[model samples]
Target: MVGDYDSYFADRARRGAETSPTSATTEPAKTAPAKPRNAPKSGLTYKETRELETLEKTIAETERKIADIETLFSDPEFYRTRAAEAAPLQKELESLKTGLDDAYARWGELEDKKSGS
Candidate 1:
């Protein structure tokens, strides 16, 4: 399957190159991206930054969703709207709470390491 996919994309690329006028040029192709350095050289600085940012964004989004559900619950008319409607929200709330807890724990661990160093 992997080879098939590679070949499929390769075929498409060939087709595209044939269709493009620039394909006739003798100019060299663009260079590939630089190889990533080892963690010690970078000490996970870039990865940790990205991870914390993504986690914070996800946590904020989850909190917003939980707040939205809470707002729905506050509506006297929405009360007992149906178990089917509220059950999914309850499930999502539980999942988000767990994820937020995990993210905070990881963030704390990263901060501790950063400070200890």
Candidate 2:
């Protein structure tokens, strides 16, 4: 029955889906530690300080990636020759933007907690 299905229905599995376990040699990606910021206020705990710094770093990285994607989108030649490639990048750009918004919200919450302490 598998062979009888239409191509569209037969290929319903999403592209980029991982189908196998990664090899042992594939080390997990390591991000550099967030850059040092102005020392946290006296009221902030060490854990809170670390979390805020990491959030700031995440926000910065996400914004940079989003800008890079936007620049690519602005170049007409990119779309003209590689429109197929744009869909994945656009999806990634949207995800990054959403993450950035969440990061900003978390940062705000952290700030509020720091102030409340």
Candidate 3:
């Protein structure tokens, strides 16, 4: 009764249907992405991979802060009269921008080395 998947069997047994054959068979085959013909011969070293991951995380966090600052800027009063709020937002925006610049520079350096440029 447990493996019986037919509607009639489920109804008769008052239990859920068994896993469908199609469900088990429906998973897409896993495949690696096609590499460019001129792609780098050497793969990323462990340190480079770790640094890229860390930089990506830092960039994402900085972007989120920028988005928060932008949202705060959307209010007219934020720009006109809310100097205190605007001050912090402006400072944060600058910091995040600097962070983005540094992250991009690091990424560019890593990519140039990887591609033998």
44: Cα error in model 1, Å: 4.7
Q: What's the TM-score of every candidate structure?
A: 0.55, 0.60, 0.54
Clash-forming residue pairs, model 1: none
lDDT of 2 by residue, 1-117 (tens): 355457656466432234324444588799999999996455568897899999999998989999999999999999999999999999999999899999999899888888875
- Residue 66 local lDDT, model 1: 77
Model 2 misplacement above 4 A = 1-43
Runs of candidate 1 with Cα error greater than 4 angstroms are 1-44, 80-83
lDDT of 1 by residue, 36-62 (tens): 876553234878878877877887887
Output the number of the TM-score-best candidate.
Answer: 2
Worst 10 residues of 3 by lDDT: 13-22
What's the lDDT for residue 87 in model 3? 77
Segments of candidate 3 deviating more than 4 angstroms: 1-43, 77-82
lDDT of the structure predicted as candidate 2: 0.84
Model 2: how far residue 39 lies from native, Å = 25
How accurate locally, in lDDT, is each candidate?
0.76, 0.84, 0.79
List the candidate numbers ranked by TM-score, top first: 2, 1, 3
